[model samples]
Target: MEIITSGRLKNTIKYLRALFIIGLILSIFFMLGILGVLAYAKSQGAPPLAVPQTSLFYASDGSIIEESHRGQKRYWVPLSEMSPTIIDATISIEDRNFYRHNGFDYKRIAGAAIADIKAMAKVQGASTITQQYARNLFLEHDKTWSRKITEALYTVRLEINYSKKEILEGYLNTIYYGHGAYGIEAASKYYFGKSANELSLAESSMLAGIPKGPSRYSPYENLEKAKSRQKIILNSMVSNGYITKKEAEEVYQTNLAFFKSEDLGRERIAPYFQDAVKKELLTQTNIDEKTIEMGGLRVYTTLDPKLQKVAEEQVAKNVNPDSEIQLGFVAMDQYTGEVKALIGGRNYEESPFNRVTQAERQPGSTFKPFLYYAALENGFTPSTELRSEVTTFLYDDGNSKYTPHNFNNYYANGTITLAQALALSDNVFAVKTHVFIGENSLVNMAKKLGVTSDLVNVPSLALGTSTVRVIDMVNAYGVIGNGGQKITPVFIKKVVDHKGDVIYEAEQSKEQVLDPNLAFVTTHMMTGIFDAKLNDYTRVTGQTITNSLTRQYAGKTGSTKTDSWMIGYSPQLVAGIWTGYDRDERITLTAEKQYAKKIWADFMEEAHTGRNVTAFKPTEGVIGVYVNPDNGKLATNACPISRLTYYVKGTEPTEYCMDHVDHYEEVEEKQPEEDPDKDKGWFKKIFDWF
Candidate 1:
């Protein structure tokens, strides 16, 4: 050792004293700064920290179909509801000295700082569970000195204001787990398809490993990385005395059943209907999108789960999965306008475009009822006769001509009654009626009956050239089904807040848009469509409506080159079905399988299984009378073909048919002014006498 002089010893001592004083002043200033931060945070008061809850959608039968939330899906639960294994695992991995610390783990922070300094980069985080909770709740996730100080002060406040158990519960509930899941409850359910209390040791370890770097250790994203993190968590658990080494090893070796992210919402019974309800919630209430996503409102809808299931099954049974055919089906209570079931597409997962509420397609002859209703609203009756021969209509300043033709080009080519025209779906008769009663009248009638789609004022409007949505079509038919009462289709029945207070409730609205007698008469005319032979107009020979259903219901069949529709209603339910390709390509439905009608019939038969078989009762001012089918005149004993037809009281036929006579004496007496069949040949004259 070298010998030290007195002057050098004195100088070294002075330098040591000066360094100690400087360190002492610096320590005092740091303590004062920390105190200032704590005081400021305390002045700011306790943070409003709560986990986001999931909003639930329930069917009319009180079964949950969907749980919707924004940003992250979270389900808050008490700490006692969590598996003890999860709590132990989380502690072992996140903050081993959590119970012993005040707010920050000073020893871990020091170690992490040293490690980060050695690496010459900020590669480590020293946030405890409480510190994380503070940052997640009150501070932005920015790696800045001011943010860190604010987080530390908030962490201290949280420790002072809450118990160790509360802080841990909050931290576990608010941490972001990968795959849009938050909280142990949601993560456990998402990963294991079970509640937190039912999570096994392996699942708990897996979830505990996710919080460190959720995306990095997401089993859905990287199975190997997640497994590595899980193994590390198991080792930590064993080292921290939570479990034995053998137990940890056994858990590490155990296979974990992971949930498929694709199947996250598979339990949702009717996603398209749920989507409709979600949209309606936004439109019908003052609830903002953010609040609706986060408020955990219980949306109660009028979706009859049984009917919805039937609708889905019927569509699946009828539509070929391999084919490009898509279908839209809607069923609703006729009087209440409550949508009981809705199938927007065959599979909502493949496409979420809801056809029922979104798609606007040509309604074809199914739109004839609105035209006929308009005619009846005017001074026309079912007994009114029109020539159903080929006719041409000029439009667009006579630049284009449209000649309507019946299916298979089969027309009566003579006088056909309104009832027969509708039953036969005679295109010429409908076009004549559309022209007789101006296009404005038909458009107005359609609007009043709930055809919300644009109805162009063209002659082809009689043929449903304009487009309309399935929901609007069902609602319009529901007008006739409900005996002339206009009803708005209602899906959501009620919505309640998390506290079970009624936030929104649907009220039934009804407007009498048509005369009850006219509606009844129109419905009766539609009933004739189901008849195998309408007096003389048979239903397309080999294609009879009788083959579709044997029920006492009224409906119309509509088809375009590419689209086919069957919308009908009994007094109880109104249902509509549409089938077509997604593209504008034609589809030739086979006679053996009329997909729309078959689907409708099957669903309707089941839907009416337990309900009463009530017939449509005619309202007052509506009367039935027999008329000659050939000439649409009052029937006489000599008339060969006669059928009973309904009419609005004052519109019934008053003149008897003069085509046939009972005897020669009656014929001569009735035709004294001219010889009967004078222009006939001698054989026909003798035949008339005989």
Candidate 2:
């Protein structure tokens, strides 16, 4: 009786233990199922899949300048546009049960699980087409269990949200292939030198094998290994009924010709300029950086391809190639402030530091125009005379002393007119005017003329001791060239997304900031910088480029110990050039000193080849008069150095120059010549003199 009771109690305890084990297993599964459902709920509002497309930069005439993609070099194509063979090969090799599975193929999973259990590790993949697409689109390629679980949940969401065709299309267009390619089309071109739609069955099968292991399966990397992978793909294609056994064997036996051209490599067109455009796209528009690189944005830029080519050629031909000297060049439309062409550095491959919009160097005499413009607004004329001799100033209640000197420590040592002062880049005249107009006036004028750089209110600021960007200086010069109507630099004219919807269009902003008449007079005065007649103890800064110019131009040249700048414009265009070392080494080379001027001259002349020569028009308040460029006095036949100068109507010189009277009379007695303009009409003579 005792033994029977003990056996019955033991059986009862065994039954209870079995019941607990079964209940625990069921509870674990139920919790896992709840977590899976929650994950699906979380993915219900997943952001739509965004396939990266190359952002194309188009020139004003619709020519492609660059195809900008941050990382993935994908040329997106819909599945309908893809070749049927590539599709079939891809489907066969990547997932055979693709069409029948909802998200997970239970049969493949069970087989993979059995294999993993046999090996006591997770190695075999049971991912279907939907599963692989979900992983590629969103998740990382880590093989951790948590990652696998997340990938599974995402797979479920993708299957529930999208159709099979959409999933396959996204997968084909977003997968990585060898040789910097990211999609089927790019891979086709990179490997076969043909479009995806034009690929044959043999080409398609070979490409279909690369994505599994790019370096291991790429024909470019290893032909034998790629062939082996290709054979497997073709066998699978035959098994899947995509091709007959004989067709598969024929494709496998064909000795395929590989693409060996360099034409399809990444194009580097104006790399520095493209950097600036990308920056502007992020800051100026409502678009994000990712969208600019991957949303297939069509950016219609103000770039002039002809001018861009000319700019590059000029820089390459004129700049000293063997030296460490760097240069920056930018050409902009004066009327609209459209940036036409840009070169940011000497060599883009060696260094990508953009000097045009990034580096800020001392502008030197290029800043003089702003000071002189302020003077013109404050009761100063082109004929206003100032002592150009070396001088010291006592500003700040005579506590601070500043001495300004011209290049090479040379000076006129006598009175020079404002026109001649600018022509020779007389430092004394510039500082004197800066003080007279108050130290802060030039800074204010620069700000109004589209200068965004910081400017210190000091006496040397008149001499351009303050550093400024080449783009800002060029933009300011555009204002002067466009009759004082200030316009900001415009890099992109409009932008359109991939859907053909206009995203951003630049609005041309023009504001009347300076007096039109005074601006015209200032512009005319600048032309004297190239006129040899204005030469004094110091030669005109732009005299070196004078012979190279074909059309009428108003220009200024600026120099410091380490920087050389040339900013100038015609009626149609404005440009700036800079040359110096990145470390600000003192310029001792003669060629380095003149590089900016030569490049500016070459680019401007060639860019304006077919364009009509347009002369600057003076307002009604301004009048053109022949004056002694040396003294700014009314011109007489006696004056040896005379030029057609513009001035506000009342500012015209009434007194004729008497210094050359006796000199000319002595010359007349020795040898008299007929007056070239004596028989011409007034307007005709003025035009001919110019």
Candidate 3:
């Protein structure tokens, strides 16, 4: 009885032990299934993809300047819009069994395991598109067995949770192709300068092959390796029924039709203007520098390519090519104040300094217009005149006196009109006018014209003694061009984000800075300055043309020792030309009008070839009546000589030259010709006598 009981106990122990082993195996499998379910849920809902922001620029004509961003980036494209070649090539090269496998390819895994064991002796890696996305989106860039296992697990979960097409689309949008490229759309523009749908089979194959290793297979860096990779891709395409074998061979034989990394067209257009626009973009959008250079973006600008070309050619031709002296130019739309053409420096590579906004030089007589405007605003008219004579200033230090002279170094010998003084750029007349009106008025007027630099409130401010930038000067002139409204100079019209969303729209704020009548009066005075109306007293050769030979325009000439400036506006365009040394050295010993005016004329002639010749109408409160040179009043036959001056209504001279009765009579200019070979104007002879 005892032996039978012991046998039963031994049998029970064996059965219990067997049950324990079976349950352990079952529990292990069940835990794995639950983990798999959780992983699958996580993969199906991988965190939303991260995308970098890109900024784009546009011109006045609504053209792109620069797109700001950096990345081997993708632009989101719908499946319907994606090219069949692109879709097929990507699938063939990345994952042949992409459609058949759940995200994790077990067959590939087994093969890769054997390959890895063989490669562990060396080095090897095989990753499917889903696995790559899993790594790119969630995993670190670590090549560890643990990481590999996680990648496989996530890839499988991705397949279970997402559709084949959905996974493919997400992968395409999220993959990094080397050269800072991201998506198919971005890659298309970066490589081909077109949309992804427009990519050719050869182009698609080249792009498709980039996934193996973008840097290694980049056509730009290693064309031969890229071709080899392309061939492998082509074979896969052929085997997968994506393309015919003959077609693949033909494509393989053809030279890689790689583009010049996009923008072949932009290069052929306004490169300098485009560069300026980009600089403005850097300031407007706080994008990272690396992204701007590597991230492909489409920039639109406000430049007129045709005008930009003309402006460039004119500057290159007129300015000394080898001279380090920089020139800054800006052309704007009269109505909108959009900067159309700009040249920042002689060469961007040599000197990155932008003279347009950076350098501040005296506007010289250019400042007189603002003084005149102030006079007009404070109750003056185009017919108003100020006494043009020898005037000396009394300073706090009585011993130190200030006496201003005209360019010709002679007082008008008697009273002269304001129109004549401006046309002649007479320093004496302008200084007197500023004194009468008060210096602060001139400063305020200048500020109204967009002068941001400090203004020396001394008497010399009337002669453009304060420094101002070329851009500011041009913008001030634009006030007259646009009647009386002040339009802020706009280089960037709009900025768009990478998603084609408008991030910043241009706000071209314009406000009335001067009375319309005053602006007109100022323009009217400038017109005669260029019309040779003061020819008897001054030589205004550069802007002066025969009425029959002339196209209607308005302009002003300025000289301040080292610099010479000529700025003008036709009905169609406003342009300015400045000539000076970069070191502030005098370009010529003597201030000459010819150099600046010639450059201005040459540039304007070419710029306005196809454009209409427009006229500036005389605004109200301005009149074109002639005045006596010897007396500041409406001209008469009895007046031996006359000069026309424009003024605001009440500033017209109420009295003629009273202090100097014999001033005109005492003038002696009878000098025997010392050199018959020396050709001189009558005014030159007068100077020789002095």
Stretches of candidate 3 above 4 Å error?
Answer: 1-82, 96-103, 114-126, 134-142, 145-195, 213-231, 238-298, 322-324, 395-400, 541-550, 589-593, 617-690
Query: After aligning candidate 1 to the native by TM-score, how far in Å is the CA of 600 from where it should be?
Result: 2.1
lDDT of each: 0.84, 0.86, 0.70
Candidate 2 clashing pairs? Answer: none
- Tens digits of per-residue lDDT for model 2, 282-313: 88996998788888788999888788889999
lDDT of 3 by residue, 48-102 (tens): 4434434444555665545545433445666666778999999988888887766
Against the true structure, candidate 3 reaches a TM-score of: 0.77
Shift of residue 38 alpha carbon in model 2, Å: 10
Single out the weakest 10-residue window by summed lDDT for candidate 3: 664-673
The per-residue C-alpha lDDT of model 2 at residue 15 equals: 96
lDDT of 2 at 658: 74
